[model samples]
Target: MRFIRTRTAKATAATLVTVPLALGGLAAQSHAQDASPSPSGTFGPGCSALAQKANTAKDKVVEAAAAYPQLSHLVSATVRAKLSGALDGKPNVTIFAPNDQAFQQASASQLASLLSNQGQLKKVLTYHIVAKQITPDALAKGSFTTVEGGKLTTSGSGTEFKVNGKAKIVCGNIKAANATIYVIDAVLRPPS
Candidate 1:
């Protein structure tokens, strides 16, 4: 009788462990099923992947810039030159990048003026960034406050997204390990 009781207790413990393991696997599968498909029609290609690669936002931005040449030029030299000191050690910065055509539209003289005015340049660039990774789908037609103490109003539908009421997101959802980059057709400026 004693031996039978001990065997029953051991079997109960094993069954309890097995039940949780099966439930855990089912939960994981359910999560996978619920995950939205990537904007590019691919699976698992957003901030989740980026977060897995880099533990922090700043590190993710740096990793993305390093991987993409065009993006690197925008954040590292053109924007970084004006914002180096202020942006150093800052975390969770989301930079909206304007393509080369956007830069081409702005006269060299205008850029030069911005470079000379560090305060204005910082304000403008920082306005493009938020302290958190805001995915394309998360954005809606509303005003969002920036890290620079300015508010940007976003509008439009689906992939036709615009920021600060002017700049359009040409290519959206380029995720970095820690940051999300949206390529826009115009640079964002604060309200004057």
Candidate 2:
């Protein structure tokens, strides 16, 4: 009788230990499943197709920078570094990407001065971004507030949008899951 009782106690203790481990494993598995990427490779819901499109915009940015060595250096050193954190989540964002010519037109000394002041540089770049995706068609004769607490004006008859009343949208409608990127001919500036 003692032998049987000992074996029963051992079995109960084993179950007590194993059950929690099993439950823990299951809980971890559930978390992994919840965090798994969707079949389309996006992290979460809404605008998966748009997110796929944004990858193309990223590529285009790289390509444009490559084609323009000086501008590419600034993009890699300044713009890309700043945008890393802002692009990570599921909120809609619009990026106004300036081309090489725009950077070239800027006074090199002024550009250098801006780069020396990181806060000002970050604000300038973020000012070109909107917190929501905006289609080219939607950007007619209106202003959109930026992430940097400034407003960017848009004006055009059709398919020709401009930012800050000047920077023309050379390429538009590059979508991401929670964002859109518009390649522009000029960099935008905040009101002094």
Candidate 3:
């Protein structure tokens, strides 16, 4: 899918790259904008944390998720969506995985219907991922492209981040061979 760069994305990219050099060769400090807070505390709600222990740099997204019981539901969804291989690649990826509790909150009929439609399921599942390797600082606030060709917005800093102002990150920065995983509390729906 082609990515349509949003205005917010452009602004963020400019900020990320425009580190102006100063007399001391350090990036100039400005009072108008603030940097992201230092990383600390738990990344999310912590249904079962993988950040503290997950360091499977040789495993793909699917392989990594399969190793954690807390991520079992997400693994099943990815499998059903036929997106397991899609998440394994050279491109850096970030997945906002929703825990089992998030899935349990959904209606039975909705999930059943989604699973039956391969295309729809793929779209929904891909919306939970970003095409870039987003770090905690970058997730402070910005718009980004998803593998499903959707626009995702994030806000907050440190351990208090939210996706599209809806889903809260439960456990973040879990390393996979090809992707970074951030477990969220709610499932993110794609735009119709």
Q: Return the top candidate by TM-score.
A: 3
Error of 1 at 104 (Å): 1.6
Which candidate comes out best when scored by lDDT? 3
RMSD of 3: 17.9
lDDT ranking from best candidate downward: 3, 1, 2
Better model by lDDT: candidate 2 vs candidate 3? 3
| Model 2: CA > 4 A from native | 1-74, 77-81
| Candidate 2: 10-residue stretch with minimal lDDT | 44-53
Worst 10 residues of 1 by lDDT: 42-51
Residue pairs in collision within model 3: 44-170, 45-170
Q: How far is candidate 1 from the true structure (C-alpha RMSD, Å)?
A: 9.5
What does candidate 3's lDDT look like per residue over 80-151, in tens digits? Answer: 887887788646798888887788878999888887899988889989889888887788887999888989
Residue 30 alpha-carbon offset, candidate 3, angstroms: 30
Once fitted onto the true fold, the runs of candidate 3 whose alpha carbons sit more than 4 angstroms away are 1-42, 47-54
For every model shown, the clashing-pair count is: 2, 4, 2
Per-candidate TM-scores read 0.61, 0.60, 0.73
